[model samples]
Target chain A: MSERLTPHAPLTPAVLAILLSLAEDEKHGYAIMKDAVKPEFGGITLGPGTLYGTIDRLLRDRMIEETGTTDNERRRYYRLTSQGLKTVSAEIARLNAAVAQGRALGLIQPKGAR
Target chain B: MSERLTPHAPLTPAVLAILLSLAEDEKHGYAIMKDAVKPEFGGITLGPGTLYGTIDRLLRDRMIEETGTTDNERRRYYRLTSQGLKTVSAEIARLNAAVAQGRALGLIQPKGAR
Candidate 1:
């Protein structure tokens, strides 16, 4: 990612939401789950096992790291890495440019229209 | 997603690469596959059925439309929609901002650093 040396990795929204939440500040596992799932998924929630499962994968991929910060005694905190941001940035840039180009062509329109 | 009153839909990069390739100009199914898969996924090319499966879904969602722009007798061209751009824009924004924020926090660093 970028000019920095980083390993290749891909993460979906569910995993991304967790990283973004921690980007502001390191947070415990439960807090991350709360922030990520709030309003976006409504009543739906990622089980503790699923949340940690993704976290472990992110950790293994070097997307996130464990931090001392936490709000729960029973939970650990996590945060993003430099490579993580770079990867995220590249992914976003790839997407943003595409979207921008599409808008330039006036492709984004009402379903009935197109 | 960006308050455009567009419908909610999530498409994978495989699907997105297809749209981005078509963003510049319309191309038929096989052409889209060639443009998207080239140098990206390497030898792993998406089958016609898979390409159309996503295309049909995107078509139904209005992320793409048959542009009457085509280069193959057995295929058809496609282009993006305004709603698609908005959706793509929002998704990229979501990712970029997160990446930016993580960098700001210095969370993005080497694996051993954190």
Candidate 2:
């Protein structure tokens, strides 16, 4: 696993969904999906197995840590570790720059955007 | 499918594997996995079907184009368009910034890197 990630092990969309959710604070399994599957993911939606699979990977990678227990239940809450936050921010920066480049070439238009 | 990617249809690892490969030059199926996997992807290599699946998506997105055909064996060569190069560059920049941020906090180390 260590060798697998040494050069680059990124957050899969499933993982990204979890990290983006935790970036706000913390949440258990199902709650993450509710938040993550907005108009953004276009309802492709993460299933139970997929969500947990990503969670397990992130936990193993130390990109996120178990923060606390939930009130209504004992569902474990995962929060982005310093490393995870850094990874997410970095990915966002890369995405932003790509968008900027597209704009420069008129390849992508802002269009009717919010 | 378009809506699914409208806000953020990023390069999945499968997709990234393909893009990174094409960034250097151009190639077809088996070759992309050979180059992309190296010691990098940790042998989670792209399958024959997976490679083409991503290639199709990239074609739809205009990130790659079907260049001239192969010589010895005709495997459709895929090349990164200008837009593709920009995306790859942006992604690399994002990754570099994240690495820099990690270094700033002493959270990640350079170690004995090659």
Candidate 3:
């Protein structure tokens, strides 16, 4: 278990989505939002309040940090810190466990059976 | 996509855990809480406020329904509706996609490598 995840209780859906968006590359708030709306993230649409608030909290927690700033505030780029990566990894592990449990209990269909 | 999941946006962590707990068998609040503390649910501890509040909402949404009651109010058993099952299955599928994305990005270790 990642230390960050345990203390944080559970990451909000928006927080996890933002962290995953930054896993591969630095992205600004809008880019994170766009990525979150992709199928992998359950097509979630984050309102401005949620997007920026989660980003602010993540920044404060040192899970992510600003990588660059632009004249346009919306272009400020951010990336996951090592801590963020670890936390996200732990969360993915947790989600995988849930998936496994669901499978065992016959809640989820086997692969290719959908 | 499950209609319930979409309109509800994202299910709260408590809601998802409660739904999963009720998936296999009818359980009262205490039983659900016990199941939640098990490793598979990430050892979450839901307070009474969150537990019963979420249960009320799930009942309102028709995701779960009371099955039986004991002398003690805490022993009111609940089970997932077909709709609840579908919603939970959909949520598990979404989480699976996130896990797969994490793996593709090398955020999660491959099985047995942890």
Candidate 4:
């Protein structure tokens, strides 16, 4: 087992999506789920089980923290910690690299190719 | 629950890595592992168990199939099926979309940005 001081790469879809969502801004659970459905986020629809389960893991991992604001008693907002930002940035870099590789291999068509 | 056909998106790292590697060319197990170590493939290192297990699943899912090349009797080669190509292509597109979103949100630095 490799031991480095950050969340592992190849993050689960749920985790990656949630973190990316939070990276944009703090949001409640429902807002994260809504953002996930947009095409840019892979059109992912997170069921409650996956959404909350991943949230729990992120919290435990210290990648995310809940805001203490009391304005909304029913909704708890969450945001990315510094560690969360680092992890998501790393993950995106990995994806960007893979995309470049795909283009070089001709596996993916050039942009605007029909 | 998504009812759309094709393997679900947000592929596990192992599965995506193996498919992307094979997308380049047919290879035996060891070759796949070798490619996984490269930086562009997310630097994923699949354990033997995970490697074989995911291979089994991919075969069962018809995304990949044994190439039946007996030139090297000890090694079994594998390649992407049409389905596999479609799957990997879609996955890359999803990643591309996410990267674009990351940029728009300023979550990821613009290329060449310091």
Candidate 5:
């Protein structure tokens, strides 16, 4: 695993989005890209360079791994590891806590309460 | 304002935390640092270098601005501009949407149902 990420280190938004995309099932690069650009995810359009670069980094950090099963010979599928799951989970909790604080401070409205 | 941040650019976790911290009241650097290291905020310990560096960048970008009121001559207080408020609100919304997707996919449990 890459030493760049400590156990509790916060993730970049791009990295977090990619992990969220693969949280459910293994997916090819193209599929991950499609999921990332959804309007809810901020409509972030990752170019091939940004997408693959993040993939490589995540792989190096053992946050994600290439799966043996591939529907297409040319496409490689990737899935989150146990570590990745834990990381994303922690991140989500942190975000939730921050949002809660925002609401308490009146900086953000509660869901369906806007 | 610095040209570095686009209206829709995703923020770094540290930057986001700072914005969220100032969402309510204007605070000094030390106060911001204290809020940022809370357990719910991920306990991210920021040394003076990292804290001031991010503050400088945020000031340049107009995401935060120095307030004229100072409790101490040595400490400078900061508050979020309209731009900062909008940016952090958008980020929280994006994160909430991502969490919803994760829950729908069974990757994350619904709040209080975990």
Candidate 6:
């Protein structure tokens, strides 16, 4: 059998979006779903199943951890761990490099360089 | 049953890297594999099975099309279709937005903003 891929090796879009949502502050599942689908953030309308599934994977990888519940008691908030912070930072850097390469190849224009 | 997701709706990192590699010029599988594994591109070392599997899906989705073979005859080159071009462009825009959000939230620093 082929070796299984790492949990976050490729950082799927949904997972990245979820990580970005929690990057600033702790948030519940619904809050994350809302933040992720904002038009400015690519309008990714992740269904509840997909959102929680990604969250479960992220949690298992130790990239994110659940803190305490909010006043609602049922709402569990999540935040990025130290490892999660480092992973997200590295992912951003890699993405930045990809964008730079895209610009260099002229497939994409530099921001405000139009 | 939940609706099946679009092939490119949430472009995976490996697929995005493959599309980026073909954005500039048509390349055979090995050439794409090489470009994608560069450290700057996130060091995504895709196995042969994984590579071909992605290629087949992309082809089935009409995101990429196989052109005539190179001089080696066994080597088949692939290029982005018009739809593929549009898809990649949109994916990049989404990623840019994510990066911008990451910066605004102080989760990540801007390029050379140190």
Model 5: DockQ score: 0.50
DockQ of each: 0.12, 0.11, 0.66, 0.73, 0.50, 0.49
- Model 2 per-residue lDDT tens digits across residues B1-114: 354323224447677667766776788767887975653322347777888887888899888898877875657788988788777655444333333443343433443443
User: In model 1, which runs have C-alpha deviations exceeding 4 angstroms?
Assistant: A1-10, A37-50, A68-71, A99-103, A106-114, B1-8, B20-25, B34-53, B59-71, B79-114
Candidate 5 on A1-114: residue-level lDDT in tens?
576445548777678778888886789989888988885444578889989999999999899999989878999999999889888877777776776776676665677793
Off by over 4 Å in 6: A1-7, A39-42, B1-7, B40-42
Give the best candidate by TM-score: 4
The models' CA-based lDDT, in order, is 0.60, 0.62, 0.82, 0.86, 0.79, 0.79
Judge the docking of candidate 3 as incorrect, acceptable, medium or high: medium
For lDDT, the strongest prediction is 4
What is the clash count for each candidate, in the order shown?
A: 11, 0, 0, 0, 0, 0
RMSD of 5: 3.1
Which residue pairs does candidate 3 place in steric collision? none
Quick one: ranking by lDDT, best first? Answer: 4, 3, 6, 5, 2, 1
Candidate 2 per-residue C-alpha lDDT over A2-105 given as tens digits, one digit per residue, 9 for 90 to 100: 45332234446566556656766677877888976663322338888888887887788788888766676657777888778777655444433433433343
By DockQ thresholds, what CAPRI class is model 1?
incorrect
lDDT of 4 by residue, B38-106 (tens): 878768888999899999999999889999985688898999999898888888888888888888877
lDDT of 3 by residue, A12-114 (tens): 7887899889997888888898899986765678989999998999999899999876658659899899889888888887787877888888877776685
Give chain B TM-scores in order. Answer: 0.64, 0.76, 0.85, 0.88, 0.84, 0.85
Q: Residue B82 lDDT in model 1? A: 71
Better of 4 and 6 by TM-score: 4
C-alpha RMSD by candidate, in order = 8.3, 8.0, 3.4, 2.4, 3.1, 3.9
lDDT of 6 by residue, A1-114 (tens): 754433467677788778878887899999999988974454698899999998998898888999976769779999999878877777777776776666666666677885
User: What is the C-alpha lDDT profile of model 1 across B6-108, one tens digit per residue?
Assistant: 4543345666566656665667777788876553322226778878898898898788888774455676777778776666555434433444454455545
Of the pair 4 and 5, which is ahead by DockQ?
Answer: 4
Under CAPRI classification, how is model 4 graded?
medium
